[model samples]
Target: MNAKSSHPSHNLPSRRTLFTAWLVLMALTVGTMLAGHVTSTRSLGLLWTGGLLLISWAKARTILQVYLNLRAAPRGWQTGFNITLIMLLLLLLGLYAINALGLIPR
Candidate 1:
């Protein structure tokens, strides 16, 4: 069985693991930038927005769980953090949808 880190405060991921995370993070960053460049109709815009939100959620969750060393934490803690991330993303998406639809004053 894998043992815990000898030093309680030393929680850095392995070099290879960190490099993998960096690659994934970079891919997500490029995906987000490309998403903004894609032209779309109003209906397609909603789908595009949803896809962007999902991708952003994935990147943020990965950063929190991997880079922040939250992956080794308890299930409850992980769930809480993930829920918080989802809620934040949902709120942001909702505001964006409203703005895109011109439902409120500019």
Candidate 2:
């Protein structure tokens, strides 16, 4: 309704940007699969887990900043979302570590 609110900076992403993000996500997924398949030894499996964590973190960042339109938000909101994302990812990594260490049934 307001002129300031009708600015082009608030528009949704272009088709090309979304397509490029999708392609990057697909490639990261393939990389995750490859990381899994390449792991033969226990150490390699640990390495694969780290790789998966990084891949997932990147994916989450991409989703939050692009698909969720968090990048254009105010600094506090953006920081809050990023903090939540990091905490959740850390929890996931912790669960994976526990499972890998045989603390729980796989």
Candidate 3:
């Protein structure tokens, strides 16, 4: 490696790749939210919201692992990311459950 490329921390996806992924994620999230408009049920609306959250999580993970080369992340970082992913999933599920139980509005 060259002198300037000696540091692993300096290696990362280009700004263009990051921005492109962000745009794609935003589009998918909006599409997921718009899915509710096709249906009249509150449960469907909640499901759409949860789906969007999960899709966003997946897209973020993909960008991290592939574009950002985070597949080789440090153990701590990997663990923390996994925890955050799980928490997001739990939150999404809880939202759906609450709506399903009639404990919250759609």
What lDDT score belongs to each candidate, Candidate 1 first?
A: 0.81, 0.78, 0.70
| Model 2 misplacement above 4 A | 3-9, 38-44, 99-106
- Candidate 2 accuracy as lDDT: 0.78
Better of 2 and 3 by TM-score: 2
Which candidate leads in TM-score? 1
Which has the better TM-score: candidate 1, or candidate 3?
1
- Using Cα atoms with residue i matched to residue i, what is each candidate's TM-score against the true structure? 0.74, 0.71, 0.53
Ranked by lDDT from best down, the candidates are 1, 2, 3
> How badly does each model clash, as a count of residue pairs?
0, 0, 0
Native-referenced Cα lDDT, model 3 = 0.70
lDDT at position 61, candidate 3: 76
Please report how far candidate 2 places residue 23 from its true position, in Å.
1.4
lDDT of 3 by residue, 1-105 (tens): 587666655667677877777788778767765764545555465666667667767777766765666755677886688688869788867867876778965
lDDT of 3 at 48: 61
lDDT of 2 by residue, 14-93 (tens): 78888888999999888877776655554544567778778888888888877877776778887898888889878887
Name the runs in model 1 displaced over 4 angstroms. Answer: 1-11, 38-44, 99-106
lDDT of model 2, residue 94: 82
